[model samples]
Target: MALLERITGPRDLRDLTNDQLVTLAQEIRASLIANVSRTGGHLGPNLGAVELTIALHRVFDSPRDPLIFDTGHQSYVHKMLTGRQHRFDTLRKPGGLSGYPSRAESEHDWVESSHASSALSWAEGMAKGFALKGEPRTVVAIVGDGSLTGGMTWEALNNIAVEPDLRLVIVVNDNGRSYNPTIGGLATRLHGLGQQLSAIRTDRRYERALARIKRWVNRTPVVGEPAYDLMHGFKAGVKDVLAPQGMYSDLGIKYLGPIDGHDLKSLELAFEQAKQFDGGPVIVHAITQKGRGFAAAEQHEEDRFHAVGPIDQVTGEPLTTSSARTWTQAFGDELARIGATDDRVVAITAAMLHPTGLTRFAKHFPERTFDVGIAEQHAVASAAGLARAGLHPVVAIYATFLNRAFDQLLMDVALHGEGVTFVLDRAGITGPDGASHHGMWDLALLGLVPGLRLAVPRDEQRLQEALQACVRIDDGPSAIRFSKDPLPAALRPVRHEDGLDVLVEHGDPRVLVVGWGQFATMAVEVGNRLAQQGIGVRVVDPVWALPTPKALIAQAGAHDLVLTIEDGGLAGGLGSRLAQECRLAGVRADVREFGIPQRFIDHGTRAGILDDLCLTAQQLARLATETVLAGDPEPAPDQADQRG
Candidate 1:
């Protein structure tokens, strides 16, 4: 049997010899490449984490010890070792394994959050809890170097350093990239000659030998005390010269390593020593190469295949190609074009320059592009500062990640009345990446921000137009949100009514379908289908979706039944806002809201999730036809209560 197939749990790894462990690491890499290539996932991160993960399992008693992975994308190797290897083939699929670490999947996964930089906090908390309970469990936090760039990691470290009783081990898996290369002061501090010094000084054997020498010196005469003090001062001086890890040591936390992450024996030795240490919290820094064993991933410079879709495993080329432009590409091209004309235009990203489509703008205006390194709050506040300096800063980030910087957006940007344009990509129900990855909360969240204008564009033209409009608003902050879905062909409106674009109108329409963003196309389909069923239907797309446009409210007044469709949370989304506006305007049309429900929606294809929610054209048409024919609009079924 193959070594991978023979292993059912982490304990099986303990039986393997050094040569067998090397073979196991090789098998894991092959398994990762072969499986992730077919299913599509965080291949590079997992590839680099293979031996490190194996070593962790060998040293620590997981589930009891609690291994908390920062961001969880790099936990694939951990999952495989802990009996989920059988489900590797079903990764990110409907009713299958989740892309990130899932609590539902295994007890081995304690933290399921895919958001970066919070693992150290989780480890600290777990360590505290275990200490309070008098449980002799060491909490292990396996964090990436990219995650260390976030401010939260330091905050947790600051607290963890003082707690001398807590048994905690923080493993810094320094692959040197998050979504892009890790930036800012922390990454620089973790760089260079620290590796050589850590290997010599931080080794467990070296520590033991030093302790023996100190014991012998203390047993001697009065010179023994002075000699030991001199030795300590010399050691600190050497550390300052040779190790960049003085940053951690200065914070009063025990620092070890810059160990070779791929070397199983070395990783195990460091982890084992860290687990045995009684001193507060220890940081074992391991230097790893992203996409370690895979030549294809290692050589492909940009992010080292950080996250990939289905690809040719051997060539590292994408397997499927789409001729249709994505909303991201359209936005990137438009932003770059705008930057070419406007010297004042600048860009900012929370370490997601490529994914957010800011790469094109970055390439041309490299000086103006600021990658804030997994810190969204910093990005937003920094954009506000840029705007204050007379530069129009366009902050491009994923919609889901914007939740992290809400305070900055509301206070620093909106309150200051700064001309900061936030471009939210992946603004709707993103598939495969699961609940945490879905960008459903931004519409609801942004609506709550005072003086912040939000635009949800339906197509490429509207996206470009929205971007142009947002940048011109100098008095307050503005945002444009678009989905991860491919850009639909531009929907030409029959007539522009105020700010509304009427895409479909049947004679003397009784039912009006108000759509926002990508849902506009779905609304048009539903409208046409309803018209065929002998119901008069009008479909309108409000390019600027938030603030409940006056024209949309007036249009809603004329219809017998109005259906507002969005791709965000139903409670506080655009649909709810428009309905509230209609009530305040005394528009008596029965308004029904259709969007994501208050509960968390599970992972599936975007189309499949929509169908399950009865948000599809066929389902909506049937419901709308019934509501109009009956002449009394009842409440729409709660998506949370409905069967998938």
Candidate 2:
């Protein structure tokens, strides 16, 4: 039987002997490597976590004793063990199993999280909830060392340390790279100290010599008193050097292990000991290699195959050419261009150097670029500080990730009217990474911030212009949000008689199409299709999506049927804002809103999602034609033609 077939669940896993378990882990690694190569999911993190995951399920009872994984990308093996092996083939595809943990998928998955450093806080809350109810259950939070760089983890650590009766096990999976670990003085010192301690622990004479010195000091005369004190001081210094537990020890949490995470026997033993310790909070630091079994992923320099698309199974080569330059690249290119001209320009990112497209900026102007690792709150506050210090700071961040630091943006930047420019990439729906990674909420959430100016560009040209305009606005916090979609080769400037442009005008149309951002092109296509059916429609593009375009409201008043289309959620989005404006303006035109619903959209191609939600050209054309002839006395087509 295949290794995956032999194990149906965690219970079946317990029945395997030690050798079989080892064999099973190897088989799982092989399968993970093969599948990820073909389908292209998170490869290295999952590969590194195979043995640790096996050890976790073997030692702890999940579901009953909930196991929460921080940034759940490392939960692929856990998903396989929980009877999701069959759906592994369609990983990250539309209508398939999600890439991250889903509470809707199974009872075993308690919390679905893909954000880093959040598992500890969730574990703390769940542990506290259990304590309040007087319930007995183990709560384990498996967090990686990279996640520890986040300030929220430390905040949770401080709280977890003080909670006297909170039973929580924090498993720190240390792989020694957060994208790329800083090769600073602290990192070098820690590396050397770790090696020295390993050598000292192995030598039996070292321990014996220390015991002998202590005994000898007790035997000496007047020198004994001072010598004993010196010995005690030396021991304290040695403890500080060897242990390196100052941070956690002061926080009042018990720390265990810098153990070999791949050794199943050692891991099992350590877990057994941890279970017995009736302490407030315990941390087990396990050092494992990302892409542990697969040589190709192991050899990867940075991120260790953190995220990938489809590739060849044997060589690990990508199956296709790189797609067009993304919005991230555009933002970076624009920033670099601006930086060349402006001496006061600086860039900031929350641990995302490559993702935010600031790698080139950092290379050219190393002193001006700051990568505050996985700390969005700090990124915003620091940007605010930089802005206050007479420098123009452009904080580039993902729209979804920016939600983490909304308060800082509102209070530290916007409220104070700081000249911080926020270049938000992936502002709209980002498909395939699943709900947690979607940039849907930025507009709704950020729009609520007082005195903040928000701008969404329709194309690459507008994006460049918006970036320039936002930075020039030194009065307050201004942001420009753009999609992750490939920009058009060239965007024709919207020719405006007033402030709005009529992109596609069909005279005396019963319907009017209002398009926001890049969705304008889709509206034009829909209008063309509607014209073939003897239906007339007008398509208008609003370059400015916020502040309720007055030109758009007047245009809506002229049509019998008005439809607003956007890529964001209908609730509190452009469509919602338009509807409110229409109501306030007392425009009685029959208005319809079309966009993503107020629910989490699943992983799929961007086009596939648009089609699924009936936002495609065909769907839009059909809806428009039907709405136009809804109340009219139009003759029906022949029964046979209608059926066809």
Candidate 3:
């Protein structure tokens, strides 16, 4: 059997010899490439952190010590050593291993939150818990250079610096990239350190100078030991001709190394020393390459293959490439076109330039584009500032990520009546990435924001129209949301009536079906199915789902039953809002809502998840049929208005 098969757990890794450990690292990388190629996951990050992870497991006792990965995307190798290697093929699939660290998967896995820059805070709390309970365990937080861009990391760092007795070890995995090259002041200083490390490695003069200083300090009597200790603390300064290494040291945290992360010996030594240090939290800076062993990932510049689909392992080419335009692509292309004519429009994203489809806009108008380093709150506030300055700002981000900036969106934008357009991509059931990745809460969450005009476009044409319309609104905040799914064929409305698109109509319609965004297609299909079953149905799409249209409410009063279908959460969704509107308007209509239940939907294909939620056309058709039959055909003369 190969070396990988011999190791079952982190404890087993301790038994392996140095040469065997190297072989084990090689085998693990091979396994990662092979399995991830088939399953498709966070390939580059896992490959880069192979040696670092091995060293960490060997140094720290997990489940007791609690190794917390910052964003958890880089925890695949950690998963392998924790007895999950056997089931690695099921990564990111329906009923298999999660791409990130899952607490349900093992006791070794502590915090599973994939949100960036929160590992330090989790580690601090755990360290405090261990200290208070008299437990002799160290808390390990393995955070990336990418995570450092988030402000929460600094908040935790500031708190951890003051706690002198906290047993915490923070390993900084500096690969110099988070999706793209890490920007901002900290990354620049770290980049300088990388350059300094290279100079120190090549030049013998620097090493000799350090040796002479150590000797001189040792030669002196009484205060020699204390002097040497002080001098040793300032050693990083001796080589600081390139970059000052006082970022962590300035915070009063014990800083160790600009060590080679790929080197197992260096990583193990740093981790071992960090584990032993109880003098507050120790920061072990390990500089590794993002796409270390993978040539394809290393060469391909954009995001270094951060997240990949199924690909040819050798060539690093996608196994199957679709020419079909995605919702993101459509939105991006339209935004870029809009930017050409509308010079007042500026774009902002929280470190997601390519993913959110803002790349084209950034390329065309570089000055107007701002990549706000994984800080959603900063992005929203900055966009608000931009809007205040008389410029229309388009803030694009994933629907789920916007949850963090809700306060900023409410206070800075909505409160001030800023004309900021927030284009939320992946605003529906995003499959495989699991619960935290789903953009299911936006419709409900945005409903609470007063004066926030929200649009849920049905197709590519509607998406373009919505974007144009949202950008034109200069009074209050406007938002347009679209899914991660492939862009469906354009569906023209049979008639446009009072801001609602009537997609399908039946003679003497008794049932009025309302669909929002992508579900509009499914609603039409449901209507067709009902039509064949001898049920007169009229399906309509509320182009803008928020603030339930007056026409829709009037239409509902005409029909006996009103069924609303949406992809968002059932609570406070478009469906729920329409029902509430009907009640408030004194329209005597039996309103039924169909949407995703207010719960965490797990990892699966979008189709599978939708089916599981009973949001499919066939399932909905059967339910609608039952509902219509169960209800009264005619309303009382004193209640419902029969005028159509």
Top of the candidates by TM-score: 1
- Report the candidate with higher TM-score, 1 versus 2: 1
Model 3 clashing residue pairs (backbone): none
In the range 1-644, model 3's lDDT, one tens digit per residue, is: 99888778889999889999999999998999899999888888888899999999999998788999987899999999999999998999899999888888999999996989899999999999989999999999999848888989889999998898899998888777742343323444465465445334334465478689888888899988899998776665654544334677677776666677788887887777677664567787777777778899999877777889999989899999899999999999999999999999999998899999988999999999999897898899999999999999999999999898999999999999999999998888999999998999998889999988988998999999899999999988999998999988888899999988999998789899998898899999999999998899999998987777899999988997787888787788887787788889898777777877778878989999887777788877877787677654333221122111
Let me know the TM-score candidate 1 reaches against the reference structure: 0.93
> Weakest 10 consecutive residues, lDDT, candidate 3?
635-644
Residue ranges of candidate 3 with Cα displaced over 4 Å: 178-244, 631-644
Order of candidate numbers by TM-score, starting with the best: 1, 3, 2
lDDT of 2 at 281: 72
Q: With candidate 1 superimposed using the best TM-score fit, by how many Å does residue 143's alpha carbon deviate from the native?
A: 0.4
Q: Write the per-residue lDDT of candidate 1 for residues 32-105, one digit (tens) a residue.
A: 99999999999998899988999999999988889999978999999999999989999998999998889998
TM-score of each: 0.93, 0.88, 0.90
- Report the number of clashing residue pairs per model: 0, 0, 0
Which lDDT tens digits does candidate 2 get at residues 1-644?
A: 88777777888888888889889998898888777777778888888888898988898888888989887888999999998887888888888878889888888898887888989999999999998998887799999736877889888888898896788888878776642343222333464454345344334475478679878888898798798888777755765565554466567676665557788876776666566566567776667788788776777777777777787766667888767877788888988888888878899997788988898888889899998888999999999999889889999988888889999999999888899988887766788888877788877776677767767777778788888887887768888877788875553633674566677766577788877777877877887787788777787777777677888887788888787777776667776677678889997666677777667778887788777677777877776677576753222221111110
**Candidate 2: C-alpha lDDT:** 0.77
Ranking by lDDT: 1, 3, 2
